[model samples]
Target: MATSPTPALPLPADRPLLGIAFMLAAGLLFTLLDTGVKWLTQSYSPVQIVWARYTGHMLVLGAYLLMLGWPRCRAIMTSVESLPGQFLRGLLLLGASTFAFLAFRELPLLQVYVINFSTPLLVTLLAIPLLKERVTLARGLAVATGFVGVIIAIGPVDWRAQPAALLPFGMAFCFSLYQLATRRFGRNDHPLASLFYAGLAGALASSIIVPFFWSPIAMGDIPLFLVVGTLGAASQLGLIMAMRCAPASLVSPFLYLQIVWATISGYLVFGDVPLIETYLGAVLIVGAGIYLATRRG
Candidate 1:
């Protein structure tokens, strides 16, 4: 009797160094995208900015799909493991984007990034309930520490007096929920399909309301709009490549580099500088995030 043929081994083990590079690239691209959004917010509504972002994302993603040929494109289009979950994930990202745009309008980019860095801590807390994941006491303290950092960064301001200050927190919360949703429902879905649905949902939702908030696009700003979408798509693709090349644990910490990128970009483009509190608070938040990521990894 002929023996059964051996199954082919999966792709060679991940190249962690390369993954780190990809992660860094993704982070930089993301910072650029945010910079563009902040710049556009000077003249556009958040709704309009968000619509341009998602629309550009769809346009770029469509070109990518076409390059992969019709068969692969067809597969990506048909493969939806969970439509509702995908839709929810899309809306969460859209909400996060909206909040980020709003926050950028009201706060400096570095401050916005510092507040958003609390996302990992929020994700840990969210996981206990939504993902039914266990958390040790040490992790709990880290989460608390991260929050303390957020409070410090925000300073002792009355909430009702500065409602706009809350935008980044909303951004962090929505992003954390999006992360949890990806953990729950994305495992079995096609990567490209998931990417497609995310942009599709955002594009559709934003398109419906964008008309009401519309402003005529200046010819000079056309390139900026395209750049926003291109950067968004490129950054996402970089993230996907990073995950494929290395375990999340190996590359996750590199995400903190975004703080550096944001700080530098904020200074160069917008002439914003971080306060002493922002630095101190960033240390705590970044430290806590690194600790949690390493432990989980």
Candidate 2:
């Protein structure tokens, strides 16, 4: 009896794995963007760093618009007025970028990431009240778990304690607000248009404030500043593609893989060690985000 070698099992044809991989790659690049932004923060004002990032993103996005030909890019830029939800979303986006940059100046790269990553924790609760969804028992537990992580990350928040710890937390809240606003305008605008407007808003906002605290950017740091914007824009492009390929619930859980990239990059570049507490809190926050997004999905 010639037993035929067991037939090979077929790989799943679903693009879920591929989408996951794309998102993870985006996560890594985004972490790298953060690191570059944080490093530049050491030499320049936070406003300057933000200006570099926004300018880079605008330039990168503008290249895409140019590639689309003038007619299409004009169509996009002209059609922007129809998107109302972008106002608040733009405000929140500006806030997150501003605060996150300021926070980076004060905290280690990984620490800033740990805090900003908690936006979903705030979103889960905000979604219920704002979206008029039913808040189930499971979600309450997830939110509870998430805040506990926030407490852990904060350690004891005394007035005497470091103010830097609060920056990422504020960054998280502002970002959550931005996401909430996105849920409103997101239904109307094309993803590229929405992203373009975000870049425009950031550039406009930063342009005004950046002048106040401007230090002449040394020619040497120009590449890093440009890389921040380029990477940030590309990350958003990847997110749009990933979301289109798969539902967010499927993609959202993969976001936490950012922690791995951040930890590794932080160690290699900055020789930083994330405390066990930071890791623990990061897990809880990621767990909560997954629980809420999965439950709704």
Candidate 3:
């Protein structure tokens, strides 16, 4: 006997608890993935880590689509015009991940996460120009408040003293571009198709440079590579499941939990504790984000 196809997504009201669980799982998986990336820097090149991440993501997604059968596979192929957009989105994501990885090499996990949280603010701002979105006064205030939090997190004007401090900000900018592209494509393609393009594009981008940075993986480190790759795909799937189960507003706030996870992990793994200013800024950033995610238009 053949297995029945998967059921349609349940309404958010029907499964709020499950949605919250999925979001929590996604956050934990993502934080663990980042921790693994930071750990692997001790031995592997950033290029190699990035390559493994995208390659594994693509492979896992492909296998999933295959299991879902032909219609889903066709959905992922998308249209010819969308190809360039997908490729650009992939490049932006690659840049975002690569820069964050580089920042992790120098910065503590808490600091990197604090800066990375600014992507929502940047995304709202970028949408005005790129997506022709109208910014409500409330949204604008939230965005402004978020930037203030970012400044506090960044500390003094002399932050250029630690140039690497800027990498996570750069990562946030690139990630916003990637999200914009995803928004553009959302109008025309399936989410899985867009995800397929992201994984494909990211893998291709890193594959170009991975050759130069390649090292034979020690037997001991193979599991690390596998963990990073699996977590990348699993975390993405978890986020998708979360949104499928509940409204984005409900699921998104859970993402802020990453800061707590990052803080704890950073202290335990790296013996790095964040400054009081970092905590203050994080509260503001998270508060602003919660407002943005839940506020009426």
Candidate 4:
């Protein structure tokens, strides 16, 4: 009876956990970015908000290129076999960002998140036709279950009454397309190069359209515009680092934690609470996603 207290168990030495931590942090940052989009949308059109975000992202990427010195910067900026894929990927992402911003303007954050979580499932399905990847029975079942989850999340869409509800789904599809394009370009281009083009495409495209909808920004709101860009770029960096540290399968599941951050932010900042059905749908979607992630190909 003289043995003092039982020794505490030692923590496991796991590098993947570090990747997961990074993924979680990235998720929180993404939620913050979305919150900024929602706030700024109150004052500006979705196009303006998107332009500000793309401008910030492009500036950050430009600064990164500058820090890399002339040779490396030129290397990343130079076109290669993947240039077309990179441009397409960038345009796809621009569409995704525009749709997401539009969705945030109308729906609550949690609702948008729940609907947007279908991107992974969409990617899995698209891989069959676009990438010629075979889906096993289990993965197929998971995809089917994911669709059911989406229907549940959407809770009956009426085109005339709730058209904005479709924006998140469109965002998911555009992002899936971007990911597919990435799969092709990933084999040829350096990751940073592809990233640079994405920023460039968005900035260039939005810069052209943003002028039509632009209104002078109030001095008070300038900081928010800056936050929108800075936070968006930072979140993407965190995601890239997380994926670099661990396999996509290991790091990807942690992205579900984003809904938690969005839920909290929506409640605190906007005083918006999701209906119980939304939570039910999110559980289904996340459960299916976990199945797909952990399933052996």
* Candidate with maximal lDDT: 1
Alpha carbon lDDT of each predicted model: 0.82, 0.73, 0.79, 0.79
Steric clash count of candidate 4: 0
- Per-residue lDDT tens digits for candidate 3, residues 175-282, read 888777766754345556666777888998888889999999999989889888888888877776676677777778888888889989999998997999898888
Relative to the true structure, candidate 1 reaches a TM of 0.93
Off by over 4 Å in 2: 1-15, 77-81
Give the number of the best model, judged by TM-score. 1
- Residues 1-297 of candidate 4 have per-residue lDDT tens digits of 000000112123436877678778888888999999999998899999999988998888788879999998887678446677778888988899999999999999998888778877888899899989999988888889988988888786687988998899888888888777776774455556766788888899999999899999999999999998987677876776566556667777788887778889999999998888898888988888878776776
TM-score of each candidate? 0.93, 0.89, 0.89, 0.91
Q: Global CA lDDT of candidate 1, please?
A: 0.82
CA lDDT, candidate 2, residue 227: 88
Choose 1 or 3, whichever is better by TM-score: 1
For candidate 4, list the clashing residue pairs, or say none: none
